[model samples]
Target: MNQTQQMNNDAVVEVLNASGASDIVLVCEHASAFIPTALNDLGLSAEARHSHAAWDPGAKAVACEMARQLDAPLVASKVSRLVYDCNRPPDAPSAMPERSEVFDIPGNKKLTRNDRETRVARYYTPFHDRLKQVLSTKPDPVVVTIHSFTPIYQGIQREVEVGILYDQDTRLADAMLEVETGTFVTRRNDPYGPADGVTHTLKEHALPQGRRNVMIEIRNDLIETADAQTSLAIQMSRWVADAVTQSKDISCRV
Candidate 1:
């Protein structure tokens, strides 16, 4: 097998099942520990590769617990986000990032069309295809893509405790913001929003159908540790359930 083929042989995509029929489908595009061995850690520092740029440290854990609480199915990526962020549009600058943290991605630095396609086929396409398959199986299911962001970017501290992002489905975002009042909640135009260059699988599929969806961003500091992850998961589960309840009421009227 070729290098990419060999890497693919051990991909670890995760799908957690809840007991009964579910009205929700959760996905964490950046949840993964998969780093190809051939590239030798992409020549990154231990800190850089382990940081948010490579993957969301506790996102999968939070997502899994939320899935259990909601009785929802979750589809998560198995490859490192550095391979290809499933949350980014194919042409997004960060989709195949050249540099993350202080390390230059030798593998991602310069690419021919074929090289890009190879990564896309191996990483991006599979992640998206799996998401599409899940949605197809359960049309109109509410899609929630979970992610975590750094508490500080560059040198600035972000005060917002949570950022709820949405494009077409403002209902959910608005609801989340309402619940988050007295707390720091921001309705980000693209704080998690989609710009022309970057958008996730949720935008491609959920926005078109006007399916109720939201991209939730919690600060990494709040979820990086096990205790923090569990706390945030429980908090998010309650709020998400409330949002779903509201959505059902609206759907019933329509």
Candidate 2:
């Protein structure tokens, strides 16, 4: 299905609503399942090529919907995470995983130092650099990263429907968690947490800049379709808006 194709820096990174008026900035690191021709589908089977390891299913649609509702800028990666997980740092092993869950990625195994460095330069750098450029345009940006996790990982079931993640700084996460979730269960750092290395994007792009940020993890099953993605984005937009307002109010408190 056209798995082999060329990619440029611009093609790998996508920026939607670059001039969007809102101060919130959205990022979806695992937005596509595209394995460039050079990578040769990462030597994955057809099923593995479209698995969660390749990308976070339906996350890009939800992030796009949220961006439209919030009038915010969104920076997304167009390449598969198997190539390089944009959420991870260059040094992290998961950035280019040899195995994801049950699948052994043949193309990712036995990498020399130069191979790792080359991928870091090609995939990770361009994605984050574009993100930095977008954040630079905003006077006061609040970073919100969007992601989806399988309800069942390695045969274990996860109960949390929405996970709000934070590291050293919890300004945004605290506020978002305080919002009453309706039917869907909401938890603070369930499924994965700081120790899981999921907050690299927030730590790198937002915290040092003194900008409020949070990582959102939704159960993939909840956002499996267009209507579901829209529904989820609508709810998340409310929580994010309220959280931003709450954070700002706390700042202005007398």
Off by over 4 Å in 2: 1-7, 249-254
RMSD of candidates 1 onward, in order: 3.6, 4.0
Candidate 2 differs from the real structure by a C-alpha RMSD in angstroms, to one decimal, of 4.0
TM-score of 1: 0.87
Clashes of each: 1, 0
Q: What lDDT tens digits, residue by residue, belong to model 2 across residues 1-254?
A: 13342346777999998889999999999999999998889899999999998899999999999999999999999999999999999999999999998899999999999999999988899899889989999888899999999999989999899988888778778888777566678888888999999989988998777788889999999999999999989989988999998886444111
Q: Give per-residue lDDT, candidate 2, residue 86.
A: 96
Highest lDDT model number: 2
Model 1 stretches astray by more than 4 angstroms: 1-12, 18-20, 181-190, 196-198, 249-254
Q: Whole-model lDDT, candidate 2?
A: 0.90
Candidate 1 Cα lDDT to native: 0.75
lDDT of 1 by residue, 1-254 (tens): 58875456337455678332686899998898568887677777777777777887788889988988888899898878888888787777688889865567777888788888877787787677767777777746888888877777777787876777776567776677666645455656534465543346657868777678888887777786788888889889889888777766454211
TM-score of 2: 0.94
